[model samples]
Target chain A: DAGVTQSPTHLIKTRGQHVTLRCSPISGHKSVSWYQQVLGQGPQFIFQYYEKEERGRGNFPDRFSARQFPNYSSELNVNALLLGDSALYLCASSLVSGDGYTFGSGTRLTVV
Target chain B: AQKVTQAQTEISVVEKEDVTLDCVYETRDTTYYLFWYKQPPSGELVFLIRRNSFDEQNEISGRYSWNFQKSTSSFNFTITASQVVDSAVYFCALSAPIYNQGGKLIFGQGTELSVKP
Candidate 1:
């Protein structure tokens, strides 16, 4: 079976722009979560969704949002990107809540 | 609040040497889960192991091993006979069922391991 997959492995955006990162969870998985990892740092939680409902959110700004589809796929959106927004966006999936998670390779975003 | 701390920012060892990475966690919940992940140069986070609060048994997998001690709230990983292929950034994480946050993992800053030939 395939693992969680993320799209546009790499992306570049200008300041004040917006970008959307997509993720496809593993087949049969029902939970999806997003994380952002800056260079030389561990990933920080962003948002988590289960069954198309928002279950958890991290210490991100209002400019960051995410939604999960019925198929368990997820999208992370960042508006008015700043230089600090540049980081690797990771998507993780699990069979249910409060379980071990599998993470995707991640989408590396660069804001200039 | 839940937090994971990896005090070692980085460690370098020659091939065939053994190295252990330290991880300390803080959480009030009695029931929780701990995990270790490896992020290679390719940048993908790979699952290494998971241990619940109830189980304190140390695990050994080939050249890798994990020591979970609830007494100290420490989960340490040891790599025996380390090889250059073992070089990567390793992360320690914690998860608990908070009021609204379920299964959300709080990750440590991560420790970069460099194994040289």
Candidate 2:
């Protein structure tokens, strides 16, 4: 089966701009999670949605938000982007809340 | 609060060498899961293994081995006969039970491995 897929493998935005990243979960998966990975650091959780409901949120700011669709696809939105927001945004899917997760290649976002 | 620590920032070894990456975690949850993920230059997290808090058994798969010791609150990964292909940033992560924290993973800073062929 195809793994989780993320859109716009790479993109650039300016400060104060908004960005949206998309993710399609694996077939039969109901949970989608978002993570931000800064250079040389491990990924940090942003949000998780299960069955189209918000399951959990991380330590990110209000500028970060996400949602899951009926088909289990997800979208992460960042508002008023800052240079510090530049990072690799990863999407992961799992069959259940805490099961093994498969991650996407991630969308590389660069903010100027 | 839960946290994972990988004290080794980077490691370099020649091919055929054996190297162990150490991971120490802190969590109050008696029931939790530990995981190992390898992030190659491709920048995708490749799952390696996941062990439960109740399972202390060591696991071996091909040239890779994982040692899970609950007594030390540690999970360490060893790559035997390392190769250039094994070079990557390896992460150790911890996750709470399903009902806790939405199963979000708590990851360590990661250890970058450089294998010289």
Candidate 3:
């Protein structure tokens, strides 16, 4: 079985630019979530989508948004990225929300 | 609101030795779940184990063990006979159990384990 897959393994953008990270969950999975992992730190939840609806959000600002497709895939978009946005973006999927999240390799985003 | 704290930032153990990583969490909700994940240098988060709020019993899974204590809101993981492959960052996470509502996780700072031969 293919695990959660993330696109654009690495990316570089200038401040104020926008970036979108993609994720395809494991087959037969319905829940997808986004997280941000700063250097030397654990992941911080960004958003959770189940059945195409936004189920939860984190302490992040309005610049961060996400959507879940009918196939349980997901996209994480960051508008006007800041230098602090330089981190790894991770996507996780599971049969149920808020449990055993099988994570992707993560997209490493660098905002200069 | 929920918060998790991992006091140890890093630990080193010789191969074939035993090591324990500590985790403490705080939440207002009575029902929630705790989890442990391992992230190696490859940057993939690997799910290790999960413990629900009511299940405080200690669990032993081969070389991995988890001790859940509700009285102290602590969930600790121990690796016996540690191997070099166990060198990674271990994270402790918490999530609310309510459905229909989006349950986001709150994770600890993580403990980086280094196993040497």
Candidate 2: misplaced stretches above 4 Å?
A: none
Ordered list by TM-score, greatest first: 2, 1, 3
Weakest ten-residue segment in model 1 chain B by summed lDDT: B95-104
Model 1 regions more than 4 Å off: B98-100
Give residue B93's lDDT in candidate 1 (0 to 100): 96
TM-score of 2: 0.99
Query: Which candidate number would show the highest TM-score if scored against the true structure?
Result: 2
B1-117: candidate 1 lDDT, tens digit per residue: 888999999999999999999999999989888999999989999999999899999999999999999999999999999999999999999996745476799999999999999
lDDT of 3 by residue, A1-112 (tens): 8999999999999999999999999998899999999999989888898888888888799999899988889999999999999999999998877657889999999999
Model 3 segments more than 4 A misplaced: B99-101
lDDT of 3 by residue, B4-114 (tens): 999999999999999999999999888898999999999999988888898888999999999999989999999999999999999999986655246777899999999
Model 3 clashing-pair count:
1
Pairs of colliding residues, candidate 3: A55-B102
Alpha-carbon TM-score of each model against the true structure: 0.98, 0.99, 0.96
Better of 2 and 3 by lDDT: 2
TM-score of B-chain for each predicted structure, in order? 0.97, 0.98, 0.95
The whole-model C-alpha lDDT of candidate 1 against the native structure comes to 0.94
Q: Model 3's CAPRI class?
A: medium
Residue A72 lDDT in candidate 2 = 92
Interface RMSD of each: 1.3, 0.8, 2.0
